[model samples]
Target: MATGRPYQLVVFGASGFTGQFVVEEVARVAAEDELRGSLQWAVAGRSREKLQAVLEKAAKKLGKSELKSEVNIILCDVSDPSSLADMAKQTALVLNCVGPYRFFGEPVVKACVENGTSCIDISGEPQFLEGMYLNYNDKAAEKGAYIIGSCGFDSIPADMGVLYTRSNLKGTLTAVESFLNIKSGSEGSCIHDGTWKSAVYGLADQDNLRKLRRQIGHKPLPVIGRKLKGRGAVFYSNELNQYSVPFMGSDVSVVKRTQRYLHTHLNESPIQYAAYTTVGGIGSVIKLMFAGLLFLMLVKFDFGRKLLIKYPEFFSGGHFTKEGPTEKQMEESSFEMTFFGEGYSTGQDPQQGKPNVKICTQVKGPEAGYVATPIAMVQAAVTLLKDKSSLPKQGGVYSPGAAFSETKLIDRLNKHGIEFSVISKPEA
Candidate 1:
C-alpha cells in the first residue's frame, strides 16, 4: 500500500503452473504500462531454483531479457511460518497463486495480515474464501490489511459482469441471471489437475461450508423485488440456443457476498443472482448429466476423491489433465458471460409495480483458466496499487465486487484484456 516496502508485490507461488502464468502477466503488464513498469515485485517459493526457472521461462516467452535479473526471488514456503513472515514483511501486497487454497492459503493470509500486507488470491473454493472472511476479516481490518479472494476466472467475470449491468442500467436493478459460454478453438481446452482436485474436495465438503456460514450468522439480505426463480438442474436456454447447467464455480456465493456488502454497507439495492454455463445441445447435456452424477458420487468419499485426483483426465473425461492444457489449446480458448438483468424503470417503486426495464451485458476474455486468470489477478493487483483511495476505508476480507466496485477496476480490465460491455441498451 506504500512506497517504502522493499518490494511492492510478490507472486507467492511463482513456480507452480498458474504461478508461472501470473509471473508472465506481471512481466508483460510491466513492459507495456509505464506505471506498472515501475513496480518493485518479487517471486517467492520454497525452491529458489524453480523460481529462477519460472522467471527464465517467462523471460524467454515474453522476450523480456531483464526479467530474470530484475525480478527478485524470495524463499518462502507454506509450511514455514518464519519464511512466510519474511516474505510478507518485504512486500506491500502478495499475489498468492498457491491453491486449492483450502490447504495452503491460510498461512500466507495469516502472515500478510500480521505484517499488515494486503493479499490477493485466485481461489475459487467457496469454503476457503468465506472461511477466511469469518476468521480474518476483523483482524485484517484492525491491521489495515485487505484479504481479497477469487480475483480470477472463477467469479470475477460473473461478479463484475453483474456490477457492470447494474451500473449501466438507468434504473434500480433488481435481479440478474448470467449465462456463461466457454468457446474453444481447434486445439480444444483443458485445465490442470489442481483445479480438478479443488473441485473434488470442495464438492466433498459442502456440509462444512454450510456449517461455516451458520457460524458467521449474518442476517439475510432484504429482497427488494420479485424473487428470482430457479431453472431446474439442466435446461435449454432458448436465448442462447444452448443447453445449460448450474455453474459449479464460486460465482453465486461470491456475487451474493458482494451484493450483501453493497446493500448493507453502501445502502445500494441488493441484486438477486444465478449463474449457469452452456454445455452445448441435448447430447452434451446428457453427457454432463452422467458426468455430474458420477462426480457427485465419487467426491463424497476419500478413496473416490483420491481416484478422482489421481486420474483427473479419466474422471473428468479429458477436461482435466495433470499436464494441463497445451499452449495452443490455451491460445485457442476464450469465454463469454452474458448477464440478463431485469429491474424497475427510473422513478418506479419496485414494491408497487412490476419491473419494466431490461438490459443485457457481457464480460468476455481469453483462455479462462490460465490466460485470463492471470490477467484478472494482475489487473486487480494493479488496481490495488494505483487506486487505493477507491477501496474501502478500512481494510478487510472482501469479494472482488465488494472491494473493486467503486474502483476503476472495470476500466482497468477493459483496457487490459477482459472486457465488460453492454450488449443491449437499457429498455423500458
Candidate 2:
C-alpha cells in the first residue's frame, strides 16, 4: 500500500511543544541524508501558520534555512475525519505527537488504519493504548496498518532495554529489574503540562482501564522462573545509592504487552520485569510522598482533576509547567536506565534451584521528555520505513518492543545518540 507514496512520513501535530522537537529531529536527519535526499516528510496540523513557524524555528536553530521552504505543511484536525483521512492517504506513515492521547489519538489511528498507513505515537497512557488494541487490532491487521504506542521515553528505553539485556545474556534471561536515574546538569529540568494532563486523566480513568483489560481477554504467559518481587511504594536502592520509587509511567504495562505478544506469537520465554526511578534524597522522598498522596486524592473527582490540570506546576513542585522547559534546561538534562537481569546458564533445567547467572545493561540518552523522545520516535519511524520486511508479517497494534525487536532500531538509536550497551559481563 505504501508503494510510490508522495511522502514517506508526516509529523502530525507538528506545532505542539513536543511536535516541534520532532520536526527538528527530522530536519537533523534530513540534513545528515542530504546526499541521499530520500527522506521525504512534512509537518501537519490544523494551523498552517503554526506549522510554518515551527519549520522556521527549527531552521534557525539547525542553521538550515532551507527547512522553512523545503518541508511541506498539511492542514488536518482530529475532529475532522475527512481531513485526517486525507492526511493519512498522502503518507506511508504518520508520527503522531498530539497527545493527552486518551482524547485525540483514536481518530488518527482510525484514519491510518482505514488508509493502510502505519502510525506511531509517544503516548504514555495505558488506557488509550490498550483501548486502541482492543478496538482496532483486527481491523488494523486486515488493513495492513501498524499502530504502535509508547515509542518515546515512556517505555522504549525500558522495553527495548529489556530486549537488549536478554540478547546480551549468555543464557535464558528470566527476570529484569530496571532502575531509572535522571540527572540535571546545573540548569535543572522540567516537563510540559501536556504530560501532566495525560497523567491526570490516565489516573482518573483507572477503573475504565481495568474494565478494558477484561474485554481484551488475553491469557497470561507461563512463568519461567522465580517471579520478580514487587518493591514497596518507596524503597532504598543500594544499586544507585539513592532513594527510589516504582516508576509511575507506562513502562511496566508496555513491556508486559510486548512480552505477551512475543510469548504468544513467537513461542518465546517470557521475562519477568519491574521498573523503578530514583528519587534524590530523604527530603525529596518526603516531598514526593506528600505530593503523591495529594495527587491520588485529587485524581478521583471532576473538580479535583480540573484543579490538578489547571495548576500543574503548583502540584508537581515546579517539575511541570505550562510554558515548558527552556532549551538550555533540555540541553542540560539527561537520563539513564540500568537493567539488572538474572537467569539460568545454558543447559540448565527449567525446574532447577537458584538460577545462577546475572548480567547488567544500560540505555542512556539526553533529556527524557523532549530530547531523547524525539530521537527515539524519529529513529523508530526511519526503521519502519527502511526495514518493512523485518517487521511483523501483517500490521496491527503493537508495543515498541514487539514491533521493532527484529529491526536495527537499537543500532539506529545508537548512531543518533541514545546508547544501549552491556555494562557488566555475565556472572555465575
Candidate 3:
C-alpha cells in the first residue's frame, strides 16, 4: 500500500505476453503480506481493452477472482512522450517488458529518470543498455532514480551467478567461464517471439553496440594485475568438457558492466567474464555451427537481414511468429547456468602466473523468458522500494550486481525458482 502515490508498482506493458506474467505476479504477491496496507497497482499499455482483458484474466490466474477489484488498469503508449511522463509520475517503479529495447526502450527510461522514479527492465540489448548509460546515467543520478536493465534471465543469472562465486571464493577472483543450459518439460518448446525478435535485431546492429561502448568510455582496467583477456568472442572451454561458444547475447556485456562498475566505483578488483551455452552431443554441435553461421550471415548481410524480418518464423523453426509463446510453453520450460571460476588466493599477494584456486556455482530457474522474468523484475522492484537505504545512494544506470546486493536479490530469487548455490570450493 503506497501512501502518497496511488500505486507502489505499475507495469507498463501489462497486456503483452510477458506483461501478463508481471501483472499476475504483482496480483499473486498482493494476496500475500507483501502489500504493506493495501494492494495498489495498475497495468498499462496502449489499448485499454487488452489491458482490461489481461487484468481480468490475471485475477483468475492468481486463483483469486476477487483480486481483480484490487488491481487497477491504466493506459500509456510508448509512442507518446507525454503519456510516458504521466505514467512515470504516478508510480515509484515501472517494470517495462515492451522491447526490442533498442527501438522502444529509451523514452520510458527518460521519463522515469526525469520524474525521479526508479525503473527496471528485462532488456538484453547491448546498444540500448549502453545508450541508457551514456545519455541518462548522469541525469538519473541527479534525480536519485536507478535505471537497472537486464533484470530478467538474460543477465540476472550471469551477473548474480558470478557474484555468488566470487563471494564464496577464498581467492582474488580472476576469471569466470559461464555456461547456459536449457531444458523443457512439456510436449513442445519455443523461445517466444519477444525474445527471438530481440536477438535478431541485436544481431543486425553489432557495430552500433561497439560504437556505444566507445561513447560510454570503457572503464580503466586494473593497473597491477591480470587484465581481462578476449581470446575470442567465441571459444571452446576445456574445463567444462563441453564445446562452449559465445552466448551471442547481452549476457556478456551485462556481466562485464557489473564487474566494471564494481572495479571503478567500489574499488573491487576487475574480473574477466566469458559466457557460453552447451551444444549437447557432436551432431548437435554441427547443427549449432550451421545455425551460428546462418545467424552471422543474417546479421552481417542486409539481404539475409531482410529475410529474417520478413519470415522470422521460418528461420526460427516456428518458435517465433505473429504470436508469442503459449502459457503452456512458458510453464513447461526452464534453464540453468553454471559458473566455473579460477583466481589467486584472496589473502595472498598478487602474482602473474598463479591462479591456484577454483570454485563452482550455478543458478537454477524456471523458463527464462517467461516464468523467471516476472519474478526477477518484481523482486527487483520490491527490493528497491523496501531496501532503498542499502542501495547505492546516488542512482544511475547500473547492472544488477552494481545496483543491488547479492543478498537482497539472491534471497528473493531463491524463494522463487531462480536460485544461486555454490557447487564447489577451493581447499583451505
Candidate 4:
C-alpha cells in the first residue's frame, strides 16, 4: 500500500444521485493498491445527513473493515460562497456534481479558481460552459486553476478521440465527423432534471437563442448536418446512413471550441468538425419528426415551454447503477467516430497530393456512461494533478482535448479499461 499524505479529492453535491456514484468511484479506486496510501478524500453537499449516508454506503461497498477508518464529509452549499470557499481551501481537487449549472456552477467555480484548486464537472450545457470560458479562462489561468467542464460521457470520448486521431495524422486536419451510439442494459432513469432546467433557461432568454444560432452558423458544417450526398440511405457507412441530429447541447460547441483551440494554440490546423446522434431507417425518421414538432412548438405556441415544466421526469430521471449491465452487456454497447480530413501530407513537400483521411474507433456497448465517465474524469483529475507544470499556468476554463494532449489522456483512459482504435481511407 502506497500510504502517505493523502491528496484531498472532494466531491461536491455528494448527496445527489450522480454525486453518490462519484463518491463510490473515488472510494473504489482509493482501496486499490496503486491509489490506497495516497488518497485523502471527502464528500460534500448541502445536507450533512445525505452526505453521511453516501459516505456510509461507499464505506460499506469497500468492505468497511478493509478500508480506512472513515471518509470525511463536508457540508458545502453552492449558494453560500463562504462555504464553497472553505471547501475549496481544503481540497486539492474538486469534482462538482451539482447541475443545471446555469444556475449553480459559477460560484463554485469562482471559489475554486480563486483558491487555485482544479475543478471538473459533468455539465453539458453549452451556453453556461461558453459563458464560463469567456468569463473565467483568463482569471483561472492567472491563478493556476484547471476548470474543466463536460468531464462525463457526453463529450470526453468524442473530444479526446478527435485529438487521438489527429495525433496519427502529421499534418493539419481539415475536418472531423464524430458519432455516439449508446445502448445500456442497466436502465432505471438516466435523464437528469438539469436538461429541463437548461431548456427553461434557454426559452426564457432571447439572446441565448440568437447566440446559439450564430454559433451553429459559424461552423463549416452544422453540428447536425445532412448525411453526405448520395451514398444512399441504405448502409452507407459502418456508423449510420441517414442524417444525424444535433446532440443538442454542449457537445456541439465543446467539440467545435476544442478543435478551434487546437488550431489556434497547438496545431494551427483549422479543422472543420461536426458531432451528432446517428439514427437510421424508422428511428431516424421518428427522431426527425419529433425534432420538427419540437421546433414548431417552440416557434408557434408555448407547447415546448409547458411540456418542459409539466414533464420534468420525462427528461430527467434515467440513471444507470453499478449493477446496470453485466460484463457481456457492457461488451455490447459501443461508440464510434469517423474523421474526414483534407490537408497536405506531413512528410513530403507541400506539393504532395492532399491526403484525405477518414478514421474511426469503436468500443463495446453499455460501457459508454457507467465505465467510461468515471475513468475519463478520474484520469482528467490525475492529469490536472500530475501535469500541473505543463498545463495552462493560469486557468480559467478549458476542454480536455484543447488543454491536454491525447497521448497522456488516451494512455490513462486505456490503462483504466477504456479501449480506443482507429480506421482510415483515401479520398476519392
Candidate 5:
C-alpha cells in the first residue's frame, strides 16, 4: 500500500522522560536484522539541546555509531499547529509520547490526520481520546490516517490479551471480564512537566463527567452503553471479591473497539466486556470510603478542593521517579488476567456454557511503564510500518489486537524482551 520511499517514523516529544526510552527502542529495533531498512526515523521535541543530549546518551547506551549520524531532529511545539503541520510533512508516521494528551495532543493529532500521517500516542487519558473520537474520527477516516492512542502500557497488553482469548473461543461470546495483576519493584512517580499539565487540566475541569458522556456518545456500542448492571448502590463479585471502580479512560473504549473491529472486520464472535481495577479486602474498604468522602467533598465543599490542591504532589507528576523496574526485575515481575464469558447456542434443547480463560505473562522488569512501554510502542510502530497491508484503510483510532494480528505483534514484542503467553483456556 505504501508506494513511496522508506517511511519516516518521527518520535515527537523525544526529549521527555518516556520520549528518551522510545528513542532507545527505535535504535534497538534499527539494529535488528529484519527492520533495518524499513524506517527512516528521528526524534522531535521543543528543545534542540535536550534532544541532542538524549541522542548522545542513547548512542552511547545503544553502542551504535550510526545512531547519532543517521537520526535527525525536528523542532515542533504542540501549541503551534503550523509547527506541527511542518513536523507532519514528509513523515508517514508519528509516535507521540508527549502527554497528558488532553492539553497538548490535539494539535499534533490534528496535524497528523490532516496530513494523512498515521499517529500514535501513549495517552492513558480516556476523556481526551473520547473527545478525539467524537470530533476527529470522521475527518481522520476521510483522510485515511490512523490516529491511535493508549499505545503504551496502560491498556495495550490487556486489550490485546482479551482479543487473543476471544479469538480462541468457539461459540458467540456474550461477555468478557478482565483482571490485571501488576507487581512492581517501585512505587512509581510522575514528575514530568507533561504530567503536571495533565494534572492541572484534570483539576481545572469540573465537567469531565459530562465530557466523558459526550465522548462516549460518539464511540461504538457495547462500549458506550454497557454499564456494570447490579442491584446494590455498589455490588461486589465474589469471583474477585473486590469493590470495582470505573476504569476511568480508554481501556474500556479500546477493549470494546477491539471487540467491535473483530466482529466487523474479521467476522469474529461478538462479545460484551468490562475492565476494572481490582481492590480487595481492607484495601477495597479504604478505596470505597475514600471515594465516598471525595464525592461528598467535591459536591459539598470548596474547602475539599482547596485541601486537594494543597496536596498537589499527590495529584501531579513529580511524585514518581523516571527510574523503572530493571530488566532483571521485570523478568521476575508477572502479569495476570482472567476473562469470564457465557455462551448459549440454539439447539433441540438450549445449552449454557460458562467458560473462563485466565492468562499470566511474566517478563524481566519492574513497572510496565519503563521497559514494557518502549517495547510495545516501538513494536506497534514497527508493525505499522512493516505490515501496512494488514491494517485497516480508515485508521482513525484502533487497539493493538484490532489494528494488527496477535501473532505479528507478539513476535515483534518477543524480540524486545517481553515474553507473553496464555495460561489457561475455555474447554471446547
Candidate 6:
C-alpha cells in the first residue's frame, strides 16, 4: 500500500517539547538504519526556522553532527488544511506528537484519513481518541488508513501488557489488575508541560467527553458469559502490599475498549480490568484522595483551573514543566507496572468466594514521557508500516492492542529496552 511513498514516516510537530525527543530518537534509529537504507523519514512543523533549530539541536544531542543533514524538514500546520493535506499525500505514515489533542488533533487526522496516510499519535486524551472513532472511523476504514491513539506511555504498556499476560494463561482471563510504580533516576527527568496542559483541559471538559462516548455507543456484552468491567474504589491491595488509588488517566478507558473489542469482534473471553497507581503508605493515600477531591472541585470553574495551572507545584506530587529529563536521566529513568490476575480456568468450578489460581505479570520501561513514549510511538508507526498483515483489516481509531498484534509489538518493545515478563504463574 505504501509502495510509491518517498518517505516511510513523517514526525509532525517535531519542534514541540515531546516532539524534540521523538526527533532525536528517530535520528538515533536512522543512524542504525543508514546501512540498510530503510529508515526514510522527515520532520515537519508550522515553522521551518523552528523545525531547523530543533533538528540541529537534536543532531547535537545525538552527537551525530550530520543527523540534521540526512533528515528532511517539511512545513505543515493544523490550521492550514492544504499544507496538512499535502503532508498526508507525501508519506506512508505520520507520527503526530502534538498534544492537548482535543483542539489540533482532529484536523490532522481528517487530512490523513482523506489522503489515505496511516497516522499514529502519543495522545493520552480519552476524549480525542473516542471522538476520532465517532467521527472518522468509517472514513479511515473506507480509505484503508489506520489511525491509532494512546500509543505512548499512557496506555500501550497497560493495554498490550494485559494481552501479553493473557497469553501465558491457559484458563479464561476473567480479571486483571495493574499497579504502577515510577521513580525518576536523576534530577533531569520530569513530566512534560504538554501533559500538564492537556490534563488540565481534559479534566475540565467532562461534558464533551460524555457526549463523545454517547456518540460511539457501548459494545455489546457476550451472551451467557461473565461480564467485563472496570474495578471500582480505591483500596489497599494485599498482592502488592501497598495502598492504591485508581489511575487518574486514560489507561482504564483504553484497556476497557480493547477488552470490549476482543469480546465483541474477536469473540475472545471477556476480561475484567482495573488500573491503579501505588502509594507508599496509607498517609499518601489520604493525601491523594484529598488532592483528587480538590482537583474535581477546581475543574468545575475556569478560574480555578487557571490558578492550578499557574502554580502546578502547589500540590504535593511533582509538577509538570516545559523542561524534560536530560539524556542521562532519560536513559536511567524507568517505569515498572505489575499486573495481578485471579480467576479459574475454563470449565473450572465457579462457586468459590475467590478463584484459586493467581498470576503476576510485569511491564517495565525507561523515562515514561521522554524516553519510552518516543520509542513506543515510533515503533507503532514502523510496525504499521512493516507488518501490515498483522493489523486489523479495516482501519479505524483503535487501541494499541486492537490495532497492532501483541507478539509483534511486544517483540518490538523488548528490542527497545521495554520488557514484558511473567513474574509468577500458577503451578501445574
lDDT of each: 0.92, 0.92, 0.80, 0.65, 0.66, 0.81
Model 5 weakest 10-residue run by lDDT: 345-354
What TM-score goes with each of the models?
0.98, 0.98, 0.93, 0.80, 0.80, 0.93
Estimate, for each residue in 33-101, the C-alpha lDDT of model 1 and write its tens digit.
Answer: 556558888999999899999999999998888988999999998999999999999999999999889
lDDT of 6 by residue, 153-271 (tens): 98889999889888887666677889998766656356766787778899899898988787778855443224335545677777778887788789988988888887777887666
The segments of candidate 1 whose C-alpha lies over 4 angstroms from its true place after superposition are: none
User: lDDT of candidate 4?
Assistant: 0.65
Question: Worst ten-residue run, lDDT, model 2?
Answer: 30-39
Error in Å for residue 132 of model 1: 0.4
Global local distance difference test of model 2? 0.92
TM-score of 1: 0.98
Tens digits of lDDT, candidate 2, 253-329: 99999999989888889999999999989999999999999999999989999999999999999999999999899
Clashing pairs in 3: 171-346
Reference-based lDDT, residue 168, model 6 = 83
* Candidate 4 least-lDDT 10 residues: 222-231
Give candidate 6 regions above 4 Å deviation: 33-35, 186-189, 220-233, 315-317, 326-332, 349-354
Q: Give the better candidate number (3 or 6) by lDDT.
A: 6
User: Model 3 Cα displacement at 179 (Å)?
Assistant: 0.6
Q: Relative to the unseen true structure, what is the C-alpha lDDT of residue 369 in candidate 5, on a scale of 0 to 100? A: 65
Stretch of 10 with least lDDT, candidate 3:
224-233
Model 2 scores a TM of: 0.98
